[model samples]
Target: MEPKAHHVVIGFFTLVAVAAALVFALWLEKSQTDTEWAYYRINFDHPVGGLAEGNAVLYSGVNVGTVEDLTLAPENPAHVRVLVRVDQNIPIRANTKAGLVLANITGSMSVQFTGGSPDSPVLNGSRENPPVIEAQPSTLTSLLSNSETLLTKADQLLGSANELLSEDNLENIARILENTRAASESLLQSREDLIALLEQFNAAGARTEDAASRVSGAANHAREVLGKLEPVIAGLADSVNSLQPTLERLDRLTADNEKALDTGLQGVGELGPALRELRNTLRTLNSFTRRLEQDTRGTLLGEETMKEYRE
Candidate 1:
């Protein structure tokens, strides 16, 4: 029997449909790994605790990639290794740290990344040897550990408090209370004196306020006086500045004539001795004149007549 043409067409369509489905399946699988991505490893000392693959890898709270795989470290089986694939554009640096944090009260845990400084260089790695982001203690681990420590400390504190509050201590506490009550009674007895003292202090404070007001007024008056004198002071400064060139010229003239001035002063000093000698001669002549007046013949004469009169 000859094959029907419709059967051939149906068979060809079936093959085409199968091919299309396979291509779509492949595209979907490749979509997850086809992007330009960088790989990083996170080695945690604690167990994964339900943290599994396909979990979100968040960079500072924003989803940047997904956990690709989880396995134990080859070198140390005690450590859990998490392989993550992040967008290549997301800068991973040496300081970048990874930690497992619960998404919310009941949600699954996610890997969080921190420490991406703008100036820090990008961490370089490849699939063969990816850069490692050291895993910090999980939030749950830290909380539980800290709570245990706090409980221990609280127990110690309670024991110490119990020891400090023994029978004798209770009696001492009662005595302290009695002393406080007596002190309170004594304060009440002197209440009026205390009130008078407070009143005096208030009066002193008022006097201080008055003194401060006076000082403020004086300061304001001084500021006003200084403001009024500012223009006068500026004018004086300008006058001095304007006369500077004349002073400088006079200085230069003095420097130039210093030798001549010194010579004139020296001549004046030399004239002093001559003047003294002339005074001596004048005194001698006066004595002679006095003798001459006493005798007209002595006046007509000179030193010989003066000498005779002296004798």
Candidate 2:
């Protein structure tokens, strides 16, 4: 009977120890730290991965707080409300961003605070509102949603490309490549011709330089000749100046001769009429002389002289 009693006592103490341990754990979970802390709420439109009460809240990767509660937001049923207890001396500014971050690959998540502007006013429960940030989709979710369509399109494209690379088509492509190679060779040959042309241009430039030098020398010779001729030209100019008065006198003499020629022409015109009158007078005299001669001849001969006197 005493053994049964001892066994009962042992069982009772064991149960009491377990109960005390559970109570101590509950107290540890519910108790606040000695440091003063304040509560702020962050709202998100989706589940914040595995974030729950007692999850660590970090500011710039340093743990500064803990999540106090998580519940669906009353005002926006689609969103969730997360209550965080942060240290009162943390100096959280209004511009601080709270983001849900995956803590590890096991799908656990936490709320992280970063990039608080120092000039911004400190946030309080009454004045603070949750900032809506851009949401990022998980890699697994994105891949699951679009992988089939992407793979299907990729497969079709690959099949089409394979069909395009068939042997006859490949031969045609080879021919095209060969033609391109020939064109490239032709271009290279043309480049050689271009180099020769540049060489010719250089030679022509040398010739032009030589011609320019010859032209410059000829111009200098012409200048020297012109310099030598300058005095001769001046002397010729002086001679022309000296002959000017003589030329003027000759001009006056020529005018006087022209006037004399005009008077001579008039005299000749008058003499022509006088000569014509003299010719008529001569003709008449000649006729008279011939008659006188004939009469004399008849008288001198003594024939018909008595008849002539009776007449």
Candidate 3:
């Protein structure tokens, strides 16, 4: 009885273990079925940087699926094509862009998805017609490349520095320094003469400026005198024009008087003496007027300033 009881306990424990394994398997299958898969292609212009098959595909840091295949494009060997399996529940829209991201500096790479809008249409793809997702340059890859370029430049600079620090180059530099010192000494020796020449030039410039200023002042004064004479000349011309009627009257009077005198002289001899006296007075008056005009220079337009200059 004791042996039969032990066998029954052993058999019960074995059955329980099998039931637990079956339940775990069924749960795993249900979990896998909840996620649906879709296909897509990612085209990269840069190197994938150690990304290989079975690499994770993520959407906003969530693992969605994995890389199904990778290949270099047949038409353009420089381009890389990647086929990825993604969760169908995740909307792979037309506006979605892709990039290769390095999770760590150890070159572990993954595909990153961004910018999928709900209003966008689905990015449907198949084995023959694989929809391409655009990939940007990876930051890590760019950094690595820049670092390599910087190192190369640094190496070149070090080589040049080493060459420049050699014995022959140092001797050449020393010669150049000595020549510069000699030139400086020569310049110092001629410094006094240079200063004197500059001082003389400055003095000449100052004298020239002063002369030009004096000339300018003289020109201004002349211009002012001309301006003042302009009105005087105009008034004198007007005075001469005003004398036209008087001259005409005087000519008529002279013609009449000459005729009358000629007639009277024939009749009376005493009339000749009186006529001569009148002629003498007229000549004296004409002479006095001509002298006055010639002396005053026709400037006495009004009597207000006449006494000031005429006196």
TM-score per candidate, chains pooled: 0.50, 0.40, 0.46
Q: Give the Cα lDDT of each candidate.
A: 0.87, 0.79, 0.87
Model 3: per-residue Cα lDDT over 225-270, one tens digit each: 9999999999999999999999999999988799787888797977
Which candidate ranks first by lDDT, i.e. highest?
1
- Candidate 3 ranges beyond 4 A from true positions: 1-30, 126-129, 144-150, 164-311
Please give, for residues 177-199, the per-residue lDDT of candidate 2 as tens digits: 99999999998979988899999
Please write out the lDDT profile of model 1 over residues 81-199, one tens digit for every residue.
99998888899988778898887676578999987777877887677788887898966867754787889999999999998899999999999999999999999999999999999
Arranged by lDDT with the best first, the candidates are 1, 3, 2
Candidate 1 minimal-lDDT segment of 10 residues: 302-311
Error of 3 at 183 (Å): 18
Clashes of each: 0, 0, 0
Q: Would you give me the overall lDDT of model 2? A: 0.79
